[model samples]
Target chain A: EAGVAQSPRYKIIEKRQSVAFWCNPISGHATLYWYQQILGQGPKLLIQFQNNGVVDDSQLPKDRFSAERLKGVDSTLKIQPAKLEDSAVYLCASSYGPDRGTDTQYFGPGTRLTVL
Target chain B: AQRVTQPEKLLSVFKGAPVELKCNYSYSGSPELFWYVQYSRQRLQLLLRHISRESIKGFTADLNKGETSFHLKKPFAQEEDSAMYYCALSRSNYQLIWGAGTKLIIKP
Candidate 1:
């Protein structure tokens, strides 16, 4: 079975520029998530979606970061006015269900964003 | 607030030596725990979950609710065992709270 897929494995943008990352989750998966991994740190959850509705986004930077999963199959995470601190790997993950005991998340290759 | 902590940033051991990666979590209620590994140039993948009580690639972890710790361990480390390991706690909605990863190096 194919795993989660992400576009533009690497990206570079100047500070204050806008950048967007796309993710296509595994087939039949019901939950999708976006995470930011800074160097030498674990991935931090940015937002989570169950189908087309958001489940949690408390950690998301509402001032500049936004994410959406319109059809429940694909998702996009956007960061406007990027800052140097935003340079990190953007990972997309998906799970077959929303139950912690029964579902394990599968991660994508991730997009490495470098802000100049 | 839920959180996971991996105290070690890097660990090195000779092949055939025992290896342990420490993980501690802070949560009031019972939370599912997991260990994830990422090999060089590979995506992050689940190594093991506390609920399954299964070993993967000679690695095993036991959840100690009394100590709030779930440390990954292997009796004898292999060169191929070198990788980045992360401990995570699963929330009710299936969202993961990850620890700062530990990089293991098994030397010959």
Candidate 2:
């Protein structure tokens, strides 16, 4: 079976620029999540979506970062006016559903972003 | 708030030696724990979960709720065992709260 897929495996941008990352989740999965992993740190969730509806986004920087799961299958995370501190790996993952909360989450090869 | 910790930044052991990666968590409720691994050039993937209580690739982790720890252990480490390991905790059965991962290097 195909795993989660992400575009532009690596990205480079300047501070204050805008950057976007895309994600295509596993087929039939109903839960999608976006996480940011800084160097030497674990992945921290930025947002979560269940069938196009946001489930959580408490950690997201609302002033600059935004994410959307359009049509409930693909997702895009965007950071406007990016900062040097925003340099990190953007990981996308999918799960069967919220009811299967602890079910394994399939992850995509993350997009490594560097802000100069 | 839920938090996970992996105290070691790096761990090195000779091939065929025993390996143990430490993990600790802080949560008020019954927590579900998981170990995720990332091999070079590979995406992070689930290695095991505490609820399953199963071993994979000869690595096993036992959750000690009393100590608030879930340490990954392998009796005989192999070169292939070298990778980045993360310990995560899910509070209230929701999305995971992850630890800063440990880099494992098994030298031959």
DockQ measured for candidate 2: 0.85
Clashes of each: 0, 0
Best by lDDT: 1
**TM-score of each candidate?**
0.97, 0.97
Candidate 1 on A47-96: residue-level lDDT in tens?
98989999889999989999999988899999998999999999999998
* CA error at residue A99 for candidate 1, angstroms: 6.5
Fnat per predicted structure, each in turn: 0.88, 0.85
Worst 10 residues of 2 chain B by lDDT: B88-97
Candidate 2 off by > 4 Å: A100-102
Task: List chain B TM-scores, each candidate.
Answer: 0.98, 0.97
Poorly placed runs, candidate 1 (over 4 Å): A99-101
For candidate 1, the TM-score of chain A alone versus the native chain A is 0.96
Lowest lDDT 10-residue stretch of candidate 1 chain A: A94-103
Q: List the residue pairs that clash in candidate 2.
A: none
